[model samples]
Every structure is written in structure tokens, then in C-alpha cells.
Target: MSRFSFNQITAKLWDLPDLVAGCVEAGVGQVALWREPVTEYGLERSAALVRDAGLSVTTLCRSGFFQAPDWFDDNRRAIDEAAALDTKVLVLVSGGLPAGSKDLAGARQHVADAIAELVPHAAAAGVTLAIEPLHPMYAADRCVISTWDQAMAIAEQHPVGQVGVTVDTYHLWWDDTVLDRIARAGERIAIYQLADWVTPLPQGVLTGRGLPGDGCIDMAAFHAAVEKAGYTGPIEVEVMNAELWERPGREILDATLTSYRKVV
Candidate 1:
């Protein structure tokens, strides 16, 4: 339980205040927050809410989308937000190829370049920029970094604490080589997120994730690999199931914790 971090998106419909109270009641001490809700609730107020409740924020859900024209400024603000929330890690979902562009190689390079530009600011803010590699299916319109190697290649170019990789089970489970690579990642692993992959993926495929142990993913294997990597950081359960979201916030948290216990 000390290592469990409930990613806020897992209970997407839960209001921030209710989520905090629910977590406190459930003995959940850590969370991974999304920027939209934080901004909507007032960043400072949200920060104080969690701080006052003794909750530790594991990471800021994401801030990348390098394809956006305002990527630089937006990511900078994200860093500030993460710092203000008292979190040390900010996950980056490197955006997919630009519209009307099919240059996969070029898009990947741009993501790397964008990270290089942000490393200084992240380091100064005492935040780690965690590059998350989404599944290959998201390559066209969601995230271009689609493998552990790609994310590590970019992260390795910067210092260890300043840049690192995010190992999310739902996104990386299909890669046969991922577990081995993850075992050797060491401190380069910034955050470890859990979500199983169920068949017949839902529309958009974004909200189709299953809770840990609820689908086909080998959660134990991932746990072993991460343990071998010496990652003693928060383990975030970040499922995004449409059906799951329909449940009450407390029910969602309870279900998530039950699933997490079965796997971990």
C-alpha cells in the first residue's frame, strides 16, 4: 500500500475534492494527477488540498504533444504545475505525427529535440521529464514514441534525473523485448503505470484499458522486471475503461485496489 498510487484518470469522473477524500478514506496516500482537472480546480487549491490531506503526487499525467505550436510554453507551464503540486515527475506523451505528415522518423526526431529543449527547465524545477512510449496503434494520431528503445534513446541523451522513461503496462505489453529492457532500466525508469489490455479494443482505443490482473497482461512479469530495475518509486494503477468510469468514484477506487492486490 505504501507504493500504490491511484492515477486520477482511473476515476475520471470523480471531482478532485471527492477523490482526495476517497483516497484518504481508502488509505491511498499517493496519486498521479492530470493537468486539466488541476487547472479547473485551481492549481494552488488542489495542491493544498492534497498536501493538507498528506497525499503525495507521483507524477503529472502528461505534457508533450510536440506537434502543437505552443508545445514549448505549454510544457514549461506543466513543469511549474508539477513543481507546485510537490511532485517530482512529469510524464510526457510525445505527440503523434503532424497533420498531413507521414514522416515517422522525422516526428520521432522532433520529440527528442523537444525534450532536449525542455530538459534545462525540468532540471531547474527539480522535476523529471518521463517520456512515455505509447503502443504502436497510437502512432498515427496519439504518440509517436512507440517502444522502450525509442523512449530510452531520447531519455539517455539527458542526465538521469532530468529525463527518464515511463513504463506503462497497457502500452508496452505487446512488445516481447520490453520486459528484458525494463529489467535493465535502473534509475532511468521515472514512473511505473499499470493497466491491462483486454481484447476487442473499444472505440478510439484510448479508454479501453483494464485494471491490473483484469485482462491478458502478465502483471507479475512486469512487477519482476521493475523490481529488478531497482525502481522503488510509486506504482500507479492508471486504467481508463469506459465502463469502469461509469461506476461511483468510491466503487472505482475499491475495484482498482482489489485488482491491484491480486496482481501485486
Candidate 2:
């Protein structure tokens, strides 16, 4: 990892301007921003904010909730937003099954088809639709793309520059075979995110992630595999703990840097 990026969700409560200043003070030259806050801060201004701070926007948080009715237009706009932010990678979290829908296979197929449709737009916008395989527990609601093979299957239909997979430790650590495949993924690996898996997950399973090295994942092994893939890109530390979010932004950045150094 050349630069450590502090993901916005890791400090969700932090204001965007304050986050930028804190990152600069912490010597973090990179960040992964979410769409909502970026939009709230105004797209052009958000881009200017990070640029003025001498920070790089690693990857836009997400776009692909294919099950949504307006996914087509929404994703295109998201692609444009990523371009506006000067980030090439736009992470896609393929939405899970539709409400009360039991056709899991159909839902998965829709995700593939939706991604295929978005490829040209993403390519035109100089963006890569990075498929993020959420953990299996999110299969029913958050994401249907829950494994490396599943994500790659859809991504392989397009060029690696336009479509690729996000290698996130919190989501992939349970899979023993993922590291080897990641080693061979080459250019298909678009972005890498870090978050440790801690036990006794909270309700909704969203804000329970631990910082790197604070849980069971062998982050060194992951780092080795990512390097083996010839990936020397920005590595984002994206922990979403409610407790961590409650702390002051500067304190969180300090702790995040400490955790990152321990694992890196």
C-alpha cells in the first residue's frame, strides 16, 4: 500500500471540512468518500476541498444497488460523480434480493445485467465499476455479490479498466481461497479496503467492524496477497464502529493511523 486512505464512514459523524483538515494534519493524503456527504458538500466543492487539501480521493464508496427501481439512472449519475471527484474507482455493492422476493438467482442475474448496462457509461466517465463482495450475511439484503468468484464473473464481461473487484479484508477474510485468487487477479483488483472482523456483531450488522489488527484477520497475509497481485494502490481503512464514530474526528484519525502502521 503506497498511501493509507481514511474512509469517511470510519468517522461518519465527522464533518467533511474537518475530516479533510484532520487527514492533512495526520499526514493522510488519501480518503474514500461516500456519495451522500459528497453531495451534501456539493460535488464540485467536495472535489475542490480534497484537491485543495492535497489529498487524493481513492474510491467513491458505492453505486450499485441494482434492485432499486431507479438503479440505471442513479448509477450513471454516480459514475459522473466519481468522475467529478477525480476518482477512477466507484465501488459497487450489488443490492440483495428485492423486498419479499425469494428469487435469489434472479436477483443475482439482475446485478450482472445491470452492471453490463453501466459499463459503457462508466468507461466513458473514466471510472471503474469496482464490485464489492459484501459478506455472506448481507446476501439477503445488502449485497448478492458475496464472494470473489461471484464478483469476478460479472466483472470479466468487461475490460479490467472499466470493471474490477474490490478486495476488502473484512468481507473476504473468511474465505481461505480468496488470497490466492487475489494474487492472480492482476489488473482486475481495482481497490482494496481494510476492516477487521470482531465477534458479537451489533444489530443490523453495519457498525460493528474493528480496526485492522484489532480482530482475527491476518492482515499481513492479505497485504502479501495484494502485493502479489501487483497492486500498489491506495489501501483504505474503513471501520464503521458506533463507538469509533462517537469519538472526536482527530482522535479517530490518530487511532486509525496507529492501527494501520501496526498491520502494514
Candidate 3:
């Protein structure tokens, strides 16, 4: 339980205060927050709420969409938010190709360049920018970084701790080469997120993730890889499913814990 962190998106409908209290009651000591909710609840207030409750903010959910015109400023603010929340890791989801553009190579290069520009700020803030590689299916409209190799290539360009990769099960399970890469990642692994991939992916394919044990992913294999990599950080349960979100918050948390225990 010490290593488990609940990502807020897993319980998307839960209000902030209730979610905090629920985690405390459930003996959940860590949580990964999303920017929208933190901003809506008032950042400082949310930080104090978690801090006062003795909860650790594992990582800020995300702050990279290089395709946006204001990405630089937005990501800078995200770094400040992570620092304010007293978290050391900020997840980066490199956005997909720009509208009317099909230059996959160019889009990927821009993500690397964007990270280089942000590394200094991230280092100064004592935060690690975790580049998350989404599944290849999302490459066109969600994330261009679609493999462990691509994420590592960009992260390796920067110093360890300043830049790293996010190993997410739902996104990487289909890649036969991912487990070995994750095993060799070492300190380059910034955060480890769990979500299984269910079949008949829904429209948009964004919220079709299953809990750890509900799909075809080999959670044990991923666990072994991260363990071999010496990652002793919090393991976050970050499932995103439309049906799951319809349940009550506490029920969601309970279900997530059950699913996690079966796999881990």
C-alpha cells in the first residue's frame, strides 16, 4: 500500500475534498492530480488540503501539448504548480500532429525541442519532466511519441532527473520490445502508471482503458521491468473508462484497489 498512488482521473467525477477524505479513510497516502481540478479548487488550497492530511502528491497528471500555441507558457505554469503542490514529477503528454499537417517526423522533433527548452525550468524547480508515450493509435490526434524508444531518445538528451519517461501499461502493452527497454531504463523512469487495454476500443479511444486486471495486459511483466529498473517510487492506478466513471467515487476507489491487488 505504501507504493500505491491513486490518480484523480480514475475517479473523474469525484469532488476534490471528498476524494481527499476518501483516500485518507482508505489508507491511500499518495495521489496524482490533474491541473483542471487543482485550478478549479484553488491550487494553494488543494495543496494545503493534501499536505495537512499527510498525503503526498505523486505527480501532476500532465502538462505538455507542444502543438498548442501557448505551450511554453502553459507548461511553465504547470511546473510552478507541481512545485507548489510539493510534487517532484510532472507528466508530459506530447500532443499529436498539428491540424492539416501529416509530418510525423517533424511533429516528433518539435516535442524533443520543446522538452529541451523546458528542461532548465524543470531542473530549477526541482521537478522531473516525465515524457509519456501514448499508444501508436493515438499518434495522429493525441500523442506523437508512441513508443518507449522514442520517449527515451528525447529523455536521454537531457540529464537524468531533469527529464525521464512515463511507463504506462495501457499504452505500451502491445509493444513487444517495451518490457526490456523498461527494465534498462533505471532512473530514467520518472513514473509508472497502470491501466489495462480492453478490446472494441470506443470512439476517440481516450477513455477506453480498463483497470489493471480487467484486460489483456500482463501487469506482472511490467512490475518486473520497473522493479528491475530500480524504480522505488509510487505506482499510480490511472484507468480511464466511461463505464467506470459512472460509478460512485468510493466505489471506484474500492474497485481500483481490488483490481490493483489482484495484479500487483
Which segments of candidate 1 are over 4 A away from where they belong? Answer: none
- Write one digit per residue (lDDT tens) for candidate 1, span 141-259: 88999999999999999989999999999999999999999999999999999999988878858998899997899999999999999999999999888899999999999999999
Instruction: Report lDDT (CA) for all predictions.
Output: 0.96, 0.93, 0.95
Per-prediction tally of clashes = 0, 0, 0
Error of 1 at 102 (Å): 1.1
CA RMSD (A), model 3 = 0.8
Residue 105's C-alpha lDDT in candidate 2?
89
Q: What is the C-alpha RMSD of each candidate to the true structure, in Å?
A: 0.6, 1.0, 0.8
- Candidate 2 matches the true fold with a TM-score of 0.98
Better of 1 and 2 by lDDT: 1
Q: Which stretches of candidate 2 lie over 4 Å from their true place?
A: none
lDDT measured at residue 119 in model 1 versus the true structure, 0 to 100: 92
